[model samples]
Target: MNPLIKKLADLSEKKSRLIIGLMSGTSLDGLDIALCKISGSGQSTTVQLIEFVTAPYSEEIRKQLKRISSVENVKLKEVTYWHAKLAHLHSEMILAALRNWKITPEKVDCIASHGQTIYHYPARDQQELMDPVNSTLQIGDGDHMAVKTGILTISDFRQKHVAHGGEGAPMAGLVDQILFVHETETRILLNIGGIGNFTYLPAKNQPKEKTFTTDTGPGNTLIDSLMMHYYNKPYDEDGNVAFSGDLNEGLLRELLNDDWFEEEKSKTTGPEFFNIPWLKEKMEKAGINQDELDPKDIIRTASELSARTIVKSIQQQKITSETAVIYVSGGGAHNPYLMQRIRELMPANEVKNISEIGLSPDAKEAVLFAVLANEMLAGKGFGMEIEDESKFVNFGKISFPD
Candidate 1:
């Protein structure tokens, strides 16, 4: 009988809700700002992606940001300052997008912001004895965003999952279950971002209709990092870098042996584990002897790593259903070489862009946060987390219109 719960119920029953979902992934390419119209919830939910685009980041901005992304020491002042700046910058972009689309903020009910994650240190770091579930930082301050944009904002989504015994990510799983679950079909929605993650919804008609989701392994993280590092490019366009290089079988074997693959990690990871240093370690271990091993091969291997990991995860599902339609989204979807490898690996599973289902692949993640924010404002939990360890929680903190 909480007030927020009642308010959420009211919103859910409303005829329409306009939400702004913002996502800027590990690629650091730019902001993916989306405006969406959504209604219903859980499997009954319907999402209409109204407008979407990937706003290009300036090279200067990208460089400054990259310097801090994986660096150990950063001025606390700088981090706090950028968090607010990010929110404000994104708010300006939102306003610009609204103007271009002939939309009004007054028409929107809420904004879902996946604030920039400067650093995400899950509980259990060795040096910090911070209480378990103590801290994880995502700047893009929501309050600043709300004040500047004059829109009610919801953000800080991961904190809730962590409070509830989850790793605080792969939150997209909640949205996936709500929007994609079908009664007779077993579905697997794969998102190949800087990392690869998946949600498996068992055939809904089965006696024990089940759902499980997990992060398999590296996605475009290493490859993209190498591209940025060696080619002065943000990412390997069309997977060309990968296609040009020969796959180092020995290197691939050594890279695959890392402990992450051997253990069971929940469907969550970020640049934290898979970065330039991690890649270099494996390459060094493999002993890249020949000059023939250009840095591009490393990129190609990483892409293949993502494709293979996803395929392996699907196989573990013991699924017999006709091709579990794999919907690709995030930056990786556009990588042709990566997609080809994925198709070859999951020949049975139909691989198509989210656009094929009426959602722009690039905008899917942004739209998801918007939906999550809507759910939070309305005060509804999309059921409990997948396991007993997680809290059956409703996420997002709201920043009201000024």
Candidate 2:
């Protein structure tokens, strides 16, 4: 047998495994490296976030990523270059993080990389195509990561979901089902990342089909873009700009008029559909001239749009559980104004940061990918069922270090 296969078999049989999960969301902010000690698999899975850190992307790196990320057109060479370049960069960040944590690569079992998403053309967004199909693209090659880091790597996870008849996103639902389902409380694991999305985990006794995940429109993407364009900041820190500005009801309504909101609950989206251009289009439709409107007001309106769409999506679920909990995570959790809006809109349900559930909100996305890699290695069922038999297959593609 190949020594690599033998090593993988041995690792799967271990009592516990140390895995590094990497996530770089559409925000183009940085890579989230989560060093996790995960044990068991499926419903019995346990994840201890041993260490977590955000490896900040330099402005140069951010610029390059933005050029290729979610844009309608780009030079093919740029995508090809970043695919490998980003993986090496991620590998370096991981190695540096391990050193900072006083650990070594050999001590880790695997690396689960949710590579940088350059384009997420879900079937819904591909109307122009003659034969549209659900598809998404994430760079940072697993082969490069595995060879450079000398650790087994699992990357390009979304393709499997698309192949299995999913929109190739919001993969968080599977992990949430395995790790967060409650005995009596219907929990909504809301992640307000570059694109807002949530996993609806019905109480343990509920039917499986009742549990699903969907993108709740823009999370921080629009607001972050506005900040960068206006304030020259990466994000609206604490959402202060939004809090200080007055909301434009017309603009908010126009933004909500998008047909995407009315789509099926189990769906996915990305910045491609909810960027600054999209916001400006909505603004134009609302008759709000960019020259006259205060940028802060625009930011405020965008923030409200995010909050309203999120609330609207949750309400659309028609969840009968008045006691359901909305555990918020992602960069939006840190934005007090955004959280305040969500809390206000969702008064009945308890709205709390995911830290209340014992996982760092910042580390949750990265950690979940680690759980996925663990499941791929040693798990039986994915803890959920879909009509597609293809969905039952292991998610991440494996890359072995020779």
Candidate 3:
């Protein structure tokens, strides 16, 4: 028997595992490395975030990725090179973090990497394609990570979901159900990264089938794009630009006219569909020239558009009471302008960051990956039967270090 396979079997039988969860989101800002101690699995599982940090991506790396982030015309060689490069970068970050924390790589059982999402296109979004299949890709070769770090690794989680007929996103629902589902309180886990997404958690008494996850559209992607284009800033820090300018309701309305808003709640999207080009097309349709709009106003309108879609999606759920708690996470939670608008739109609900529940907003994504890896190691029968022939299942492909 192979030593790696034997080691994995031993890990599967262990009562606990130390897993490092890595996330490089659509923002391309940095890598969120979380050293998590996870014990048990399923409803009984527990995660202690022993260490966490955001290792910033250099400006050069960010630029190179931004150019090819979601475009279809990328060179195969570039993609292949970045796949290994990201793995090496992640490995270096992990090693540096381990040194800082005085822990060795051997202490860690696995690395759950959410790699970098290059593109995500569900069937609905690719209706024009002759063979429109639900597809998504995250590049950061797990094989390379395992080789560099000498730890068993799990990555490319989304591919499993797509293969099983899911939108291949908002995969957080399984982890949320495992870790955060409340017996008596209604909860919504809202994550606003480059894209805004949420998982609705009904109280135990409520039908579990009612619980679902969906993307509420743009989060920081559009605003971030405008900021970079107009101000040479990566993001509108504290939403200062939005606060400085007037809200253009007309432009806001134009932004909301996309068919996506009215589509089924199961839909998922990314910066690909909400990029500057899409915004420009919408502006033209609304007869609003780019020159006529101040950069600040553009940022403000984009911000409001995000807020409105979020509110609309939550409202569509029709929770029995206004007392449901909304735990916000991701980059948007830190943006006062965005938070204020969401609060204003949902006045009766309790709105708070995930930190209130003991997870840093910035660290939630990485931590969730840790939970998924734990599930793969120790969880059983996570698949929940849905209307379709497919069932929601545990997702991750493991790579062994040789």
Candidate 4:
């Protein structure tokens, strides 16, 4: 067997670990770093979020990142350089976070970094220019993180899932299961980040049944764009912009007609596929003036789109064995307008923040990948694809120290 495989085989039998997980979503807001103490594996797996924080990006870095994040044909050199800079920046943040908490890097067993997603083309329509069946890239030099922090670092967790005939996203499913599964109560961990993704945790009433998770639609991406485009700010504070605006019915319907929503739950998307350019095209097709359209209305429409997409998905679920409870997290949770819309859509579900369940809604994803790093180093499941995640497959890439 390969040495990596052999090492993983040795790891699967461990009982507990202290790990750090890092995530930087498409919103370009910042990196969410979570420190967790994980015990057990598989259904018995438990992740305790010990310390969490999001090290926000500086204005300059944010602007640079936004330039290439989801656009087509960006300057290659800049993207390459930023990838390393991000690793260094994240490394410094982790070191600072650890020191502030009085915890040494050695005390933590492993690190998981989701890296920065530039673009996500989830094996959708194939074309002559691309091989849609496989490929996904998240750049943030993991080796730099491992060397600087003096700990084993696991980054880029999505490739393995894609290698196994799965979309590179919605990797949140396993962590959602490990953290939220209950014997008699079903749970839906809805992360309303730049994109709205959900993990449906069936009550332990049916452990044998398959779990469900998928990206619903736009979350904060569009709302954030409207803010920057008009208000010259990063994002809408408390969703004030949307709160102040009225929804434009024509725009809302046009937004809803995209083929993104007409897919099986396995689908996924990103800003690359749903940015201002796309929305502008749609509006222009309808002869709407891009300048006259209120940025506030754009924000409101995005929020409404998120709500409608989520409701549509919930209505199509085939679940019958679990009692569904909704737990929300991410930047969107702080958006009062978005939250209100969510409650209006799913009035029956609790629709509370992940904090209500003893987890930081904002820090959950980072901590999950941290646990995934522990799994990788310890071999929770070796040479297994998600399809054979008989146990949760270990995630992350090993970053060697020099």
What candidate 1 gets wrong by more than 4 Å, as runs, is 1-13, 124-135, 289-292, 317-323, 388-391
Give the TM-score comparing model 3 with the true structure, all chains together.
Answer: 0.97
lDDT by residue for model 2 (203-239), tens? 8767553676788999999999999999899999988
Candidate 1 residue-wise lDDT, 1-402, digit = tens: 877566556666786688889998777888998888887765557888888877877888777677667567998787877887788888998899898999888787888889777676665332556455534567788999988888878888877767777776777778887777767766777788887888777656764755777777778888878887789877888888889987877888987787667545454556877887777777788886535567867677777777777777667656535646777887888889988988887767787887776777778889889878767654346564464336454777877665
Candidate 2 C-alpha RMSD relative to the actual structure: 1.6
lDDT of 3 by residue, 78-193 (tens): 98899999899989999999999999999999999999999888888877889988889899999999999999999988988888888788787778888898888889999999
lDDT of 4 by residue, 278-374 (tens): 8898897767787897777877877788778877766667652225778888888898987898788777777788898888888878877876676
Summing lDDT over every window of 10 consecutive residues in candidate 2, give the lowest-scoring window.
Answer: 384-393
Residue 394 alpha-carbon offset, candidate 3, angstroms: 3.9
lDDT (Cα, 0-100) at 153 in candidate 2: 96
Residue 282 displacement (Å), model 1: 1.2
Clashing pairs in 3: none
**What is model 3's C-alpha RMSD?**
1.5
Best by lDDT: 2
The TM-score obtained by model 4 is 0.91
Superposed Cα deviation of residue 50, candidate 2 (Å): 0.7
Give the runs in model 3 whose Cα sits over 4 Å from its true position. Answer: 385-393
